[model samples]
Target chain A: MKLDSRKLKILQAIINDYIMTAEPVGSRTVAKKYNLGISSATVRNEMSDLEEMGFLEQPHTSAGRIPSDKAYRLYVDKLMQVRSLSEQEAEYIKDLYESKIMQLEQVILNTAKVLSEMTNYTSIALAPQLSMVTIKHIQLVPVDKSLALLVVVTSSGILKDTLIHIPEGIDSDYLYKVSNILNAKFRGKTFAQIDIRDLSDIRNELAENQKFFNSLVDVLTTSFREAENREIYLGGTTNIFNFPEYQDIIRARSFLNLMEEKDLLYNILVNSRNGGVKVSIGTENPYEELRGCSIVTATYSLGDRVLGTIGVIGPTRMEYSRAVSIMDHMGKALSRYLTKLYGEQP
Target chain B: MKLDSRKLKILQAIINDYIMTAEPVGSRTVAKKYNLGISSATVRNEMSDLEEMGFLEQPHTSAGRIPSDKAYRLYVDKLMQVRSLSEQEAEYIKDLYESKIMQLEQVILNTAKVLSEMTNYTSIALAPQLSMVTIKHIQLVPVDKSLALLVVVTSSGILKDTLIHIPEGIDSDYLYKVSNILNAKFRGKTFAQIDIRDLSDIRNELAENQKFFNSLVDVLTTSFREAENREIYLGGTTNIFNFPEYQDIIRARSFLNLMEEKDLLYNILVNSRNGGVKVSIGTENPYEELRGCSIVTATYSLGDRVLGTIGVIGPTRMEYSRAVSIMDHMGKALSRYLTKLYGEQP
Candidate 1:
């Protein structure tokens, strides 16, 4: 039951064939189609032994064999060679970044779309978590006497704005004084660090505009709460139905339902421990609904901090080497871009 | 081919049956299912007359008839009685808005999701255009000596923020002073109004900090340029596969490709001028790629201003009456919520 070199070759051929055609690979077809320099009988014997060792699976008694989840894991981990992205694909990624000076949110959105369009699989990108980032500045703009817009900027260049209602007769000058005093006292502090104790002195200084000032402080301190609700950007969700495996309504429904749960997707990306390409084959995915699919995720980092993850979801017979390599490249590219954009934190 | 009640009855039955089952409706089947109290021969005669009048089409000589685009138009215009939403469905929309104090962007997002999930069709929502909105307030929050966050509050409560680098040693006080001057001069003005002359006086006032002050003004005036890029929120794009019409990959690809073109979608939403349920059936849709689809859009308003659109894309055989009714109700609900949130612009 040992996986010899010949056995590994047979397994790779089966997986590659299944990924391309979505059909089970028989030894006869492999012998004819692949330059394995082996006899059909020999390939059949290896496939049977591989199945016995759990690397291949036969759907029916007389049918061809397909690679099992264990086989995919083995291939992804050791046997498969990382396919270099085509020059055009690399150029496409480069051009995407260069085409416009996109905000970080737009950049992440475009990355998800490019991945899905290139791989023809559903792509998911988790927006970078902002809770750990410190608050760099808070600005309020006057819309009118009765309302002001609150803008929060993080040190990492993330910007969030919310609208807050103010009491009537609070003039523009009053808002400016409050903004100046608050920034002087509370700048550079994280949301977790700010509380009533830190704001009491500033609150007293703005006693003339006490109600509006208190509301502004409340809005600023709780500002992180809004950004903490990380958005999950999904692209090409319907690409799953293109696969024969998901053509069945029952299977398709499960995947559609699973993709709708943003929290579950976030958890999947968060559960990956390292900032490297990680491939979870079918049955290895923690969620029951996702057991029929395979997911490959690569976490992108900014400086030392891993900010978010980008992933591709496809049928178990996915183009693992290609998806992995593309994801790996994208992750690095995103990390490079983010680092360049925000590395000078001052 | 004079207009008659019998022909209308037969056309309605055919459309209703085809919409529900996606199967062509034979005269015999329609008569039996609809309890029209007509003989098969009489029903068949009426169907033939309706087909001659361009209300129905037969896929094959022997097969049952399906409603044509012309038929759908007639049905939507006159025959189809708007289906009332189920209590559960009504409660879902009510609960969505009540659950959180969502900003307009979030509200549009949730609306897209609710439409797609409820109707099982792809939903699209465009964020309100910012050009028409007047500048209400601006706030500056200091992140550091070399960076500050710019916050723009539009008169309509749309909050936008951006990060700009500043000269080293520029303190929070300088930003507050600049913000106060900008608000004092530019309050209640549009992005169209802010120019160098308006800021020249303020610029001279802050001449000691010329470089930093100029950049602040440049960032503030140019800030609306970014917000002007309208965002298209899409949900349930894959739900197209649930219909038999898009089972072919070519048809599905066309729809997917069409959805990816945000400009095209924005144009489609924008061209619908009036504020009510609008249905574009099949070839009536302006874009070639969308000719196979039907779009049901409802425009949501903020006070008297028509903000943006919310829509559903489905196969031509879509449940028009139901989709229209839901869209109409949701649009009003969104408008009401937005008005309540940002109505008083005093």
Candidate 2:
């Protein structure tokens, strides 16, 4: 099983064909469709060799052979030529940035829409990971006797504001004083680098307002964790129907049910967080609902910080070359738009 | 054929059985099961009359009869006694609000989840209408040379903060001064009540910074319009697979596709906004994708201000009595939680 060049070519052709038609690729079909200067006999011999080497499988005893996930992983890593996006798709991405300055959420959402529309697969865009973003400002504004507002602005212009309890009553001057102290400690530091355990000295300084101080720390900690478990925006969820594998009620049900569970999707996207486009095929995905699927993801950043991931999900027979190319370009486009949006590198 | 008690009872029995079994009802089966004190012969004759009156139809002449959308509408309007939610369902809702204070978005999302889980049907919850909520506080915080944060707090504790352009160099004191004037005009007024058309006199004072003022007003107007077109949360989208009608690929595709469309769902929910529970059945729906579905909605409010609608959508053979009761209670529970979250009666 040395995987000679002729055998590799046959395996590649079978995978490319299966990705298109979702059917097993027979030697005759491949030989007739692709001019590889080989007869059906030679193609059939190579196909058998490829199957023996674990790159192909016969779904039925007498049917044509389909490429395995191992084959796709091979193609994605080496053999496949990543095609550039069509003019229309590039325009959609260009227009999203050009149409006007969009909020960060809208920019991520539009990226999901473009990816899904361009490659008829379920697309996901995770929000920027605020834990990785440096805190630029912190303010505590007194709202009323029982509630106060905690506003934290990040370096890339992302804001997190929540109504926190002020059970001890609001001392406007005191709250502003605490906010100033917090600003001094937290500015230019990522939440991941800052910890409650490291701030015992500051805690002792606010011993009289311990309850309010605890609430303040809780809000910041919660925001940091929430960013780690950020929102997953999905587009073309129903596009799962386009594949023959998901036409079955049982299969579609499992996939759609998986969509309802955010923790699982969060983990899936988070695991795909490499600096560049990464492809996870079939059993490579740990989630059972995705055992029959493949995922292609790329990290999209804000400013110089890698924010989160954006991906395309489809049946294991995915158009990996195109999906990777699109994701790579989309991730770059979003980074540029976000950096430009926040006044060019903040 | 003027409807009589016996005919109405038979039609009700048929629709009830169809809702549970998703099968057409036969007169013999109805008489045997319902024990309606009528013979099969009597029930059969009444069924014929009901079909003639357009309350029931047969897919094939040889098969049993099924209830029409008109029959379900009638049942929803006059015949069905809205049963109270089960003890378990009541506890689920009570626990949601009682557990902890939740953000408004989370409150709406959890409501949809509980509704869908209780009824085993796809559920929808529209976000609270900010246009109906009066403004409580407004602030403009200067971020940098080119950006400012616009923070608007609604009376109901909803916060909308967006980054707006500061085209002119930041004069921190001037922005604060202008903010005071804007607050004097906007406080205690709903976005719907406050319009750019009424603020021309104030525009004169801001004529020197016309571009900045225009950006400020544009942000407000967009926020107002966006609140009118707020997010619609969905739960149990795969619940469509539970119905036999959506088992077919074409039917399920259309239903799931409709799930992705927020504007159509927005219109559907908005049209369903009455003072109480409203049921739109089958052909009564305007959207073609929903022709075979029924939507039951109830208006949930914050204090006395009507916020938005929460709804359940399923095949036309909807469990009307249970869904109506659940929605009625769920809407009230949400209203109570929201009012309480905003510190009550504000």
Candidate 3:
């Protein structure tokens, strides 16, 4: 119960073995496989003590011991050693980022792909939150005699466009002039500010075309208001099949179904509520469906402004040290790239 | 060994029963379940003839018959009945379309969701090809000190926006003026035209900001050039597990992997070539991994202008009649919506 260094070593041996083979670890196997300078009898006594302390459990009377969620929690929090990525893996990540990616959405998507491929687990990335970002410009373009396009740009380098119906007789030249007037008036305002600010001047300028001008402003306001809706990018979801725990069809279906629900995934990542790498082991996860899984999350940010979260989901016996290290590095890299993109701090 | 009338009826009963139950259909089962008014011996004789004609096969000597790819082809082309959807299913689709959806992307994504849910198979929708559509409008929005957003609207109701870095000291007013001038020159022009047209007039207009102007035009050109890059929307991929054929983990993984490859899916949809509901059953498919699968595709179009494709992928035992009917209906619905959107006939 005291969990002295000897007992701790026995627990570490059990967890490490279980993680590798996904099989229970017996004292005799631990004694034979590990150079712990201990006899099988001594290892057995220490294993009994660890089990009594609730860090390990036996599946059956004749079986070896498996690590309980408690043991994994302890390992992740205290006993685990972070391993550096292999030279090949580091080079792979380097090559992935070296490609000329022009958009932040692509960056986030590629991050999900690389993480899922490297870790061999499902990866989810939440796109940056854009609500507080200010609008830099708005443009209206004529599509035909009956419809036009509305385009909005935000300070943090996000682009959104929407189509709107326009009244007839609005020629391309006339729409161009209106686009200029609107952009000059609305530039550098946040969506929140635009929502509250008066655009009477522009409204009066286009008063003769009141119906078209009003609809244009309404569409722009709605686009800005809806900017915070985050897009969830998921990768390698079927890798769930490779894990023995999910080989059962029912369990696999539940896990796969959970990945498809974007709102639930977004909530899971957002609720981590941690600024740095945080490991949620087994039942520590908030959702009942995910209680059988382990989630490792890290927030990406620019200065103190948190952009979003990136996470990896795997069986409870995940490669935590490796996943945590990768996430930590990725968080920093994403933040650096975004900061460079915005050309600012915070 | 030609399939006579009785033999065709027997083959249809076996294939129908096998599709529904995923069990081998014997002569007795068909005689009892289908009320074919023939003795088991007579039914068995006809089944033997069908088998010799390459329309049925036996998995084992003691087992009954299952339809081969050849038989499914004949049945799809001739024998299958077009069953009307249930009232609840019709209502579900009507409700989905009745929602206040505005964007074409959202419509396609929602269509994928509804199709997968209704058919209980994985669905993929390829967005309309952008290259053939003329540029209807162009707007430039300011993002920040160093960034800007370019919004393009095409005649076919498609909107694409991109972010670009900007030089220091350019104002929103100037960008507006430049946007107006560009619209005067380039509006109603196709990307194909822009690619070939000389831009000396606009180049001279922004001669002081020639570097910025040239790069801006270059980015716009690149965006237009890459317009044909199709966007694939996938839904209900986990439904792959529902079919007995893909219950094998390896088979399911391969199917899921194929969906992740966008280019391959684009090719599959494009190579389908036909403008109506097309069913490729089992080994009839071109891709080796999908040889065990069936894909039902239908192209949605307005007049002579083909927009893109919508398809459902499932095991060879898929309910082809229902999927084909659904695709045919949904294809027409999509074409109607897109035509109303672009407000023109091809």
Candidate 4:
């Protein structure tokens, strides 16, 4: 349905008021608050037209109107004004970036906490993924007669290690030789690029030292596959209960159940995989359980490769323009940090 | 509040029936269902006394009785039936143990999931503490011209690694020498045992290599203090919503807020630090927000030293007997697995 300028202004006023007050908007409320330069009767007529176009809904004939999901989509896409962060909010973001986060996990976790505190909504951040990183080095250290430790360092400065048990009688000298061979063969390659052919070649080279070679390969495979343990840090999950819509216990429980599933969270962030900021409003998400929620997500990258996602979650009635701006700023800040830390530019 | 066997049996029956049905237990219903070898009138008289003693409450003056916090405490302490796992439950536990949980984080995460599934309640597991684990070995591997990786292997087979920057002009040969000295001095000692005094002595021992020695000590000390990142895993948090008490969104939100705080969970587990199973009934928790819930926890150990905790969360009307038995079985199984993995018995 086509909307004229007058109708558009009326719709925008209703959406903005509804977003702020979480109450249905009436012609009188909009006329009094927004000064749209129209009579209440004329404004009411335009609202009725907007409702017919599916941009608004009235709980009852006597009550005011609320923005339908359609209205929210339009507002987010074209009408809403993207607001700059207040001086205080800007300082909070600056403080987060300046604070010394000891590890990548700490960075993501603290980011989520800060977002939730600033916006009063739940926040989630996925740790930087190992697949986006290349193997920089590998080392094996003997722990006991039967156990050895395998350590792998990625180019992005991420460190991971695991313990492997070598067969009895395996000497430290032989272990060191095997470590060097594996490192020489696999260095600078991403895990996804390393294949069975490479494994077979390593095996063939160490044919004379079969047991030690097999154990070393097992340790390397396990260490690289350890990326599956990449965790999603969730902050302010309890904020869901603060919303009036979730005042029903059953609704709150369903939302909590959805949040607990890692796969669900992964899917929610997957749309941001293309290395850009994305906002998914209520009902825009494919999952029915998330129909009442909105997600504002951005991908953090090291150079051109997207590492992972950072996002905030809240009720569909959340401030979309502000959330979008915050996420956009965070993505840029994160990219800059990664470039400095890893000596690469996106 | 002394009670004879007959009065105790009636109270027990009331609690058991109310827990299963989530209904106020009438004397007639308990007398008919439990076959307590007593008439309805006799049961009613005992219930009246139990109420007077603060063990039971009535929704209305004429309604049947429900177990109060004191009643649940009494049941958990002295009346709940402790039973062994069924064959199916035992098989589930065995499967969890047999699965190859490669990382300590995975082990804790999966354990919480399995515990929640088995008991149909919220489950929490704290990760193993590093302060108690002795360093078995340390390796420093050159990652690039500018960086080196620090790998530390603990006695329990957990490997942790951190990336350290190599100072300008430091060669691999000097790094190897420093690594050797670190291995000689720090191996077999906990991070807590290493001090600035020890670093000064080592610095004097290295003489001309003071820069390398100081940098190495800084890296090691930083890695040790980073042990504070140990996480607590929470699973099935939504299960609380299934309880009738949490039907109110306010109550559910309050509970979720309490659970989301890491310090709150850590404190809850640490309070049960005594080397045995613990049952904290409603109002027993030190936190006011958790007063409506009952926490059943057990501290698992590595030999004589307490390592971490495993527990379940449910409403006060929860099945105490089942939760306690499940926690007990898991605690023992986890201890056995860790002992086998570490090659030591607790």
The prediction achieving the highest lDDT against the true structure is: 2
lDDT for each residue of candidate 4 in B1-346, tens digit (9 for 90 to 100)? 6887877788898888988988899989988999978889988889999999888999998899999998888888888779999999989989998986556667777889999999989898888777777778777778787677777777766667666777667776777777777778778886667665666666876677566666667766776676654578888888777777777777777777777787889878866878778988878778887877888998777666677899999888889999999999998888777767774412
Model 2: colliding residue pairs = none
Residue by residue across A1-346, what tens digits does model 3's lDDT show?
Answer: 4989988888888899998888889989989898799999999898888888899899998999999999999999899999887898888777877776678788889999888998999999988777656666566666666777766666666667677778878887787787777677766665656653456777887888989877876776676667675689988888888898887877888898899888889898877646888899988888888887999988887556777889999999998889988888877777777776664423
DockQ of each: 0.37, 0.56, 0.61, 0.68
lDDT of 1 by residue, A231-346 (tens): 88888887886898876666766687788799999899877737799999889988888887999999987787778899999998988899999999999998898888776464
User: Residue-wise lDDT of candidate 1 within B1-346, one digit each (tens)?
Assistant: 6868878888888898999999989878977988989888899888888889888899999999999999999999999999888998899889877855537777788889988998899999888877656677676667766767776777567766666778888787777887788778877776666665787888788888778776776666666465454688889977887888877666766677788788999898887747888999999988888877899999988888778889999989989988998998899999898888877555
Candidate 1 has a TM-score of: 0.87
For A251-276, candidate 4 gives per-residue lDDT tens digits of 77777777777788977776577867
Worst 10 residues of 2 chain A by lDDT: A337-346
TM-score of each: 0.87, 0.94, 0.92, 0.94
What does the lDDT come to for candidate 3?
A: 0.81
Ranking by TM-score: 2, 4, 3, 1
**Candidate 2: lDDT of B17?**
92
By summed lDDT, which 10 consecutive residues of candidate 4 chain B come out lowest? B337-346
Q: RMSD to native for every prediction?
A: 3.7, 2.3, 3.0, 2.5
